[model samples]
Target: MEKRVAIIGAGTSGLLACKYTLEKGFNPIVFEAEEGVGGLWRHTIEFTKLQTTISTYQFSDFSWHSFAKEESPNSQQMLHYLNSYAQHFSLFPYIKFNSKVMEVEYVGESSEEMEIWELWGGNGRPFFSKGTWHIAVQDTKNFSRESLIKLVQQQTWRPNLNRRMMALRCKSTRRHLETGVHQREVYEAEFVILCIGKYSGVPNIPLFPPGQGPEVFKGKVLHSMNYSALDNKIAAELIKDKRVTVIGSQKSAIDIATECAHANGVKYPCTMIQRSAHWFFPELNILGIDIEYFYANRFAELLVHKPGESFLLSLVATLLSPLRWGLAKVAESYLRWRLPMKKYGLVPSYSILQGISSCRIGVLAENFYDKLKEGSILIKKSQSFGFCKEGLLINGEAKPLETDIVILATGYKGDEKLQSIFKSHVFQKYIIGSKSSSVPLYRQIIHPRIPQLAIIGYAESLSNLYSSEMRCQWLAHFLDGNIELPTITEMEKDVKVWDDNMKLHAGEYYWKSCIANCGIWYNDQLCKDIGCNHRRKKGLFAELFEPYGPKDYVGLSHKR
Candidate 1:
C-alpha cells in the first residue's frame, strides 16, 4: 500500500504506466481531467485517420488486427482500441475520470525510519501528505464540452495550489465552469508518473509581425487543437462563400485543407499556405512491405549509427553514403512521378532522409492530387505572415489576401505545460535547461535530479505507443528496485552524448534528438538494460535484412 503512485493522464502512456505498475505490484491511481479515456484521439475530429498504419500504432501486448478493419484506422476506431485496451486490462476501475490535477508539489523526501506528513492549505479540503508525497487535483462536479475546453486551456498558473486558486479564477474562465463548490482533493502517494503526452494543450500560434493590433483581422481564427468543436454546420457557415486559408503544410494543415475542400466543394476554394516543402509518404507499404521495414529496422540503423565520439560508426555511414543517398533519391523521384508536387511548387530542396530525420514527414492524403487538379484545393507558398486590415500579409506582399477564416495548424507547445507544473528551481536547472526541448532524461524516463518521478512520451519514436510501452516497462522495473540508475554525473553524461549525436546529425533542435530517427540504437540500449532479447529475427539473412516490427517485441518483457 505504501507503494502508491499517481499517474497524471489516462492517455496511451498513462494507461500503459498503470498496466506496468500493476505488473510490478504497485498501486496506481490514474487521474484524467476528462470524463473518458482516449486523450487527443477522443477530442480529434471524427474524420481524422492515423498518421501511421494500425500495425505501427499498436501496443506490444495488444493487437489491432482483430478490431481495426482499415489499414489505418480512423479516430473513432482509435478511440475504440484505447477503450478496449483499458477494459481488457481491467484498468477502468483504477482510473478517476473528471479529476484534474491542479498542482503537484514535492513536499519533502522520505526515510524508511520516520513518519512524515506535509500540509498545504488553499483551495478546498486542506491537503495533507500522509505518504511520502501528495498531488492536488481539481474536483469536477460535472462533465461538459465547455468544461473540457477550459480544462484543456488551463488558466490556473501557479504550481502551488494554496497560493493561486481565486486569482486563477479571476484571470481565466475556469471559475465559470465550477459549480460554486471549490473543492480540491490531494492524493498521498510515493511516486508521481507524469504521462501527459504532447497533444492536449493550448495551440502554438506565432505572433504576427509588428503593428498587428488585437482587432487586426475580421476573420474567425482558430487552432487545430479545437478542430473537433467546429461542427459541420458551423464549418459550412464559416466557409460559406469565403476564402478559407489554412496556415501550415504539416499533417493537420493538410487534413484541414482537404476537409474544407470537401466541405465547401467548389464554393469556398480552400487554399493551403505552405511555408516550406515537406516530404509526404505517398504509400504506406513500399514494394508491398511496411515502410518501417525499409528504414526503421535494425539493419537500417546499423548503416547510419553514430556511436558518440566513435569514428567507426561515422566511417560506416561515410562509406555507405552513396547507397543512402541513392535510396532517398529514388524515393523522391518516385514521389515526383506519383504526384504533381513540382507543378504545385511543393517539391522539397533536401533529401527525403534528411527531412525524415528532421521530423517533417506526413502521410499523403487520398485523392489529394485529384482534388488539387480539380481546383477545389489550391497551394500557396509564403515564408512569413503579417496582419493587414483585410487579412494576412504574406511574405511582405503589398496586398493582403482576403480570407474569412484562418486555421492555424501549428503544433502544440509540448514541454511548456510540463515545465509550468514544476518549480523554477526544478524546471530550469534540471528538467529543461535554458529554453531547450531536451528533457535530459536518462533513457528518456527517469530524471537524475527529480527523484521518484518518471516522465514518459516526451521522446519520439517511429511509433510513440511502442516507445512508451518500453519506457513504462523500464520505469516499473526501476521503481520496484529490480534495476538501479547510475550516478547523476553518469546520467548527465549519457544525455549529453545523445544531444551531441543528434546535433551532429540533425542540427541543434531538441526534437531532432528523438529516438524515432535512431529507433534500433535506442531500443537496443533499453533491451540491454531490461534483460530482453532485442534481436527479433534468427537466421543470418533474417537478422540482417528482415524488417522488425511490433510482433517481434510482443512478450519481450517476459523474456527478462
Candidate 2:
C-alpha cells in the first residue's frame, strides 16, 4: 500500500506540501476549512498587496513573470494566482474543501510503555511506522444540521418524539450538550503535516481589568479579523459617517486606517492609537536602489551572527559589527528624508536591522503621508488604553475620545492556535514550552518530542511563500528517506543556539519564529540536509555578492 499523508490546510504551505509529497510518490489528502483555497489572501482588505516583491515571493518552480508584470500583486490577483497554480498541478482532486480537522490522536504504544532513550520518537522502531494518527474531520457544509442532530441526540430527546419536535428543541438542547461534541469522521494516516498560516485564525486581544473591557463601551467594537471578513462595500459603509479609532501600529492597522481615510475623507478623521513604534519604509527602494541589493546576499549574512557558527566566523562577525551599524544608519537616514516620521514622533528607537530581524517592519500605503497632512488621519501615541462609555480612554487623558467604532488591529496568537489542535495533552505541552520560550523545532519543521508529524508555515521570513516552499520541499525529502535527523539531544541544543541568536538580534521579540535576515543561512542548512550543494550560484564572487531569491533554489528536490 502507498503511504498516506494527511495535510491540514489548503493555503500556500499546504499546496506546496501536497505537490511535493506527490512528487515523492506518496498519497496526500488536503483538508481545508474554507470553501476555497488561498488562506489569508482570501480574507484581506481590498487594498492589501504583497509585502515582498513578486520575484522573491513566487514558488521556485513557477515564475510570477508568466502571470503578470506588476512588481507587487494585490490580494485578489494573488488568490487567482494560487488557484491557477493548484489547477496547473492538478491538485484539486486531492483537496477536500470545507473540511475541518477537529482533533488528532496517536494510535500506538504510549511513552509509558516504551523504554527511555535519548533519541526522539522511539528507540527500536522505524520512525514512520512507529505510530499512526487518527484525525477527526467535520464536513463544514452540513455543520449546522449535524450540530443540531448531535445536540438533540445528546440531551432531552425521546425515542418516540417526532423528528420535527426534536429539531425545534435544538436551540435549548445545544446549551446542555457536552463541550466539543460534533459529528465527525475518523481518518487514519501514516504521516500528518500542518500547514496553517500563523498570521490568521486566532485573534490576540489584550486582557483588560474589570469594567474596562469592550462591555463598557457604547460604540461598536470589532477585531481586525471581523473587519477583513466584511465585503468591500459593507466595509466602506461601516465607518462612512462615524468617528473611527484604530488601535495598533502594524501592517493591518495601517491598511485599515488607510481605508477609513478613504471612507470619511477629512470630515471625520480616522484616529490611530499607537502603543509602540516600528520601522516602515515608504517603498522597497532606498535612494534609487532595491533594498535586496544590500541585505539578501551571502556577504550580507556574514556581517551578522548566525546560530552554531565556528569560532573564527564569530570573530569575523564581531569585527564586521561596525559595518552593519553603518548600513542601518544609512537606511534610517533615507527613511527620515522621505517620510515625516520625526515630525509625527513615529520613529522607532531600535535600529532598522533590529526591526527587520524581528519582522516588525512594513511598507506604507501610497499617499499615506498625504492623508496625514490633510487631516484625514490622526496619530496618537499611548502606552496603554481601555474602553470607556463613549469610546477609548487613552493613557494620561482625563476624558475619552468620542467615537462610533473601535477596531483592534492586534495580531494573532499563532502558538496557542497550534497547541489547541492536538488531542493529547502531552503533545500540546511539547508544542509550546514556557511563556518566554520560542517554539522548539529542529530545522523549524519537526518537533523532537512529536513523532510522525511535521509543521510548516509557522516560522516566518521576508517572504512567507518562499520560506514555506523550502520547508515543504525539505520535509518531502525527509519523508522519502533522502535525509536523516539528528538525535533529540543534539536537536534541542541546536534549537537553543538559534534562540540565543534570535534574542541577540531581536531583543524583546525573540519569541517570534522569524528568519528575516538569516534566510539564506536557513536555506543553506536545508540544502545540506537534503544532500544537495549549498552553493546555488556559479562562482565564489557572484555567490557572495549576488542577491538570492526563489529562483536560486529551483530544482533543489530533483538534485537530491
Candidate 3:
C-alpha cells in the first residue's frame, strides 16, 4: 500500500503542511473540523484585524501585496486571503471539511521492539516507515444528536469544568462506546501533522467556586468564542442597549469592548474588567519609524541570549544587557507618550521586552483611547472577580456590578487541547508533563518521543503565519530525506536550552512557546538544519540591520 500522510486542521498551518508535503510528492489528507477554512479567523469578531503588518504575515511563497495598502487586514480579508492561497495551490481538494480527529493511537513498535533505537527518527531514517498512526475521525455533520447526548452522559462532560478536562473525558469515552448511533471512521497514516493552532479550539475558562460561577449570574454569560461565532449584525444585536462587562485584558477583550462601546455608546458604557495589564500600543510605530527596526533585526537579536550560544556570544549578550534595557525603555516611553495607558491605569508592570518575548503585546484598535476619554468605555483593574446574581463581583467590593451581558475573553488552552488529542496517556504525558513546564519539542516541530507525529503552529512568533510556513517547509524537507535530526539525547538537551531561554526572557509566561523576539534566529536554525543558506540577505549591513520578514524566507525549501 502507498504511504499516506494525515494533516489535521485546514488553517494556515494545515494548508502549509498540505502544500509543502504535496511538493515533496506525498499524498496528504487534511481534516478540518469546521465547515470551511480559516480556523480561528472564521470565528473572530468582524472588527478584528491582523496584529502584525501584512508583509510580515503573508506566506513566503505567496504575497499579500494586493492588500498591501491596508497595513492590517481585517478578519474577513484575512480569511479571503487564506482562501485565495488555498485555491491558488489547489489545497481545497485535499481538505475533508467537518471531519474532526477524535483520537490518535500509535500502533507501531512495542516497548521491547523500540529498545535498540538511539538516533532520532529511528536511526536517522524517517520515522514514518517505522510506525503507523491510527486516527479516529468523526463526521461532525453526520453525527447524531442522540449519540452526542450519550457521549456527553457517558463522559460526564460538564460546562463548568475547564475545557482540558472535558476533552480528556470525551476522548476517554470515545474508546468504550458500545452504541452504533455514532458514525466514526478510522484512518491509517504513516505520518500525522497537527496544525491546530493554539488560539481557538478549547477556551481556557477560569475556575470558580460553586456559588460564584457563571451559573449564578442572572444575565446572559458567554465566552469570547461564542460571541465571535455570531455574525456582526447578530453580535451587535446581542449587546445593543445592554450594560456590557468584558472580562480579561487581551486583544479579544479590547476588540469586544470596542464593539460594545460602538453598540451602546456612553449611555450604557462598556466596562472592561482586567486581571492584569499587558503592553498594547495604538500603532506599530515610534517617532515616525516602524517598530520592527528596533527589535526585529539580527542586530537587535544579538543583545538577547539565545539557546546553545558560545562563551564569547554569552559574554557579548551580557555586556549588551544595558543596551537592551535602553531600547525597551525607549519603546515604553513612546507608548506612554502616544497612548493613555497611564491615564487609565493600564500600564503593565512588566517591561516591553518581556511582553514581546511572551508574544503578549497587542495592537489596539483605532480611537480606543478616544472611546475611553468620551466615557463610552471604562477600565477597571481587579486582582480577582467572580460571578454574582447581578453580574460580576469584583473581589473586596461590596456589591456586584449590574450588567446584562458578560463576555469572558480568557485565552485558549492550546497545550491541553493538543495533549487531549492523543489516545495514549504516555504520549499525552510526553506532550505536556506538567502545567508549568513548556512543551518540549525539538525545533518546535517534532517531539523526540513521538517521532512519527510533527506538530506545527503551537510555538508562536511575531508573525504566526510566517513561523508556521517556515516550520512546514522544514518538515517537508525532513520528510523528503533532505534533513536529519539529532539523537534523542541531543534533541532533549536542545529543548531544555530553548526552554531555559524562554524562562529567562518570558518570566512567568514562558510556557507560551513564543519565539517572537528571536524569530530570525529560530528560522536560521531551521535553515541550517535543512542544509540551506541561513543567511538570506546579500550584504552584511542589510542582513544585520534590515528587518527580516516573510520575503526573506521565500524558496527556502527549494534551495536545499
Candidate 4:
C-alpha cells in the first residue's frame, strides 16, 4: 500500500507539508482545528495579528500580495490573501477542518508486544509545533521499549525507519457542540494537520496579579485581540479624552498607542506601562514580506529593520536579552551617529535587549515619542507593583488615571497543553527514555530510537522568515526518506553533550530549569546529523554554528 502520511497544523508548515507530501506520492491528510487556514497570518489585522515582517512570511514558491508595497499587512487583508492562496493552490480540499485529534497511538499491529515496540520507537505519534515542546519519558512501562522494538521489526513502518507519529485533528469551537459550523458537521479523518496557529484558543489577557492579579481592573479590561475595529472609533473615544495607560509596551502597545497618537492628529501622551526598556529597529523584511506589507496599509513605524542584516539577527538579540542592554546602548549610540534620521514618527521603543521584541506583545513604544507629543498617551515605564480600583500602581506609587477600557496587550504562554497529554508516569518515562535534557527527540525533529515519529516546528528562530516554511521542508526532507536521522546512541549523546555544555557555561549547579528547546540548538543538531559528507549537504556555516557564543549570535545566519 502507498504510504499514508499525516500533516498536523494547516498553518505555515502544515500547508507546506501538504504540498510536499502530495508531490512525493504520500496520501497526505491535513487537519486544522480552526475555522480556516493561514495560521497566525490569519489574523494580521490592526486589532488581532502577529507582528512578524512580511517579506519572508511564506515559502519560495509563494509570496504575499500585501508585501508588494506595504511594510506590514493588517489582519483582514492577510485572512483574504491566505484564503486566496489556498484556492489558488487547491489545498483546501485535502483539509479536514474543525476536527480535533483527541488521542493517537500506534495502531493496526496485531501483537501487543509489537504494539509496545512501535510505541517506543522514534517518530512516535503526535507531531508537535514550533515553540511547543515536551520532555521525554524516563521509564519503560509507559512506552514499553521491548514491545516497540518488536513492532518495528514486525510492522511495515515508514520507509525512513522512524516510527513516531504526528497525531492530532482539527476541532470546532466548544460552543459549537451545542450547534455546528454550517454543514461541515466536523468529520474526523485518518490523518491530521494542525495549523491551529501558534497562538492557541482565545488570546488570553493575563491578569497582572494572581488573586491580586489586576484584581482592580475596573476600567473594562480587554485584550489587544478584542480592540475596536474602526481606527477612528478607538481614536475618537481614547484621544485626549482620558489619561490612557496601555500596559506591556510590545508591538500591540506600539500599534494602539501610535494609532491613538496619530489619529489625534497631534501629540498624544499616554503612560506606557512595562517593566524594562525595549530595543527598536526598522522593518526591512520578515518571512519574505517587506515592511511595505504594513506601511502601505497606513501603519506608521512599518519599516522595522536595520540596513544590513537578515531577520534572524533580531531573534538572537531577543534570545540573548540577558546580555543585550549594555551591548545595545553601544550599538544605538553608534547607529544614531551613523544613520541618524532627520525625523521619525516613533522612537523610544519597548523592545528590550537587541531590538526584536519578546513574544510580540502590545509593544509599540517606538511610536510613543511621536504619538506622545500629542499629549494623549503617557509613557509609564515603571513596573506595576500592584493594582487598585482607581488605576495601576507603579513602584508603589498609586497613579489613578481616567480610563475607559483596559486592553491587555500581554501575549501567550509557551504551549504546555501538549505536554499534559502525556504528563502521567507512564507517558513521561516512555518518551524520556535515557535522555539527559528530558526531551529525547533527535535533531529536534524525530526520536532516534523510534524512527517513524517526527516533530517539526518546535524551534524558535531569530529570523521569523521561512522558519515555519523551511521547517516543513526540512520535515519533508526527512519524511521523503532523503535525509539522515541520528542513531539512538547519537541522540542520547547530543542530549548529554548539551547538558554538559549547559553545566560548563552556566556553572554545574545553575538552574537550567526554565530552558525550553530553541532553534539554535536544533539547527546545530541538524548539521551534526548530516552524513560525514562535509562536501555534500553539510556546508561550512551549518558546521560553524556548533560553537557559536551569545555575542556571536549576531552571526545567526545558517545554510541547509
Q: Give the per-residue lDDT digits (tens) of candidate 1, residues 55-173.
A: 77898778998787878788778888999999899887777776778766665543321212121111111112242455777866343446545665532121222211222211111
lDDT scores of the candidates, listed in order: 0.69, 0.81, 0.82, 0.43
In candidate 3, position 458 carries an lDDT of 89
Deviating ranges (above 4 Å) for candidate 4? 47-55, 64-67, 100-197, 202-216, 225-244, 262-269, 285-330, 334-366, 420-441, 447-453, 495-560
Decoy 3 TM-score against native: 0.92
Q: What are the clash counts of all predictions, listed in order? A: 0, 0, 0, 133
Deviation (Å) of 462 in candidate 2: 0.8
Task: Give TM per candidate.
Answer: 0.86, 0.92, 0.92, 0.60
Using TM-score as the yardstick, the better of models 2 and 4 is: 2
lDDT of 1 at 192: 81
Model 2: which residue pairs collide?
Answer: none
**Cα-based lDDT at residue 535, candidate 3:** 89
Between prediction 2 and prediction 4, the one with superior lDDT is 2
* Model 3: residue 254 alpha-carbon error in angstroms: 0.5
Tell me how candidate 1 scores on lDDT: 0.69
Question: What lDDT does model 4 reach?
Answer: 0.43
Q: Please give the distance, in angstroms, between residue 330's alpha carbon in candidate 3 and its true position after superposition.
A: 0.6
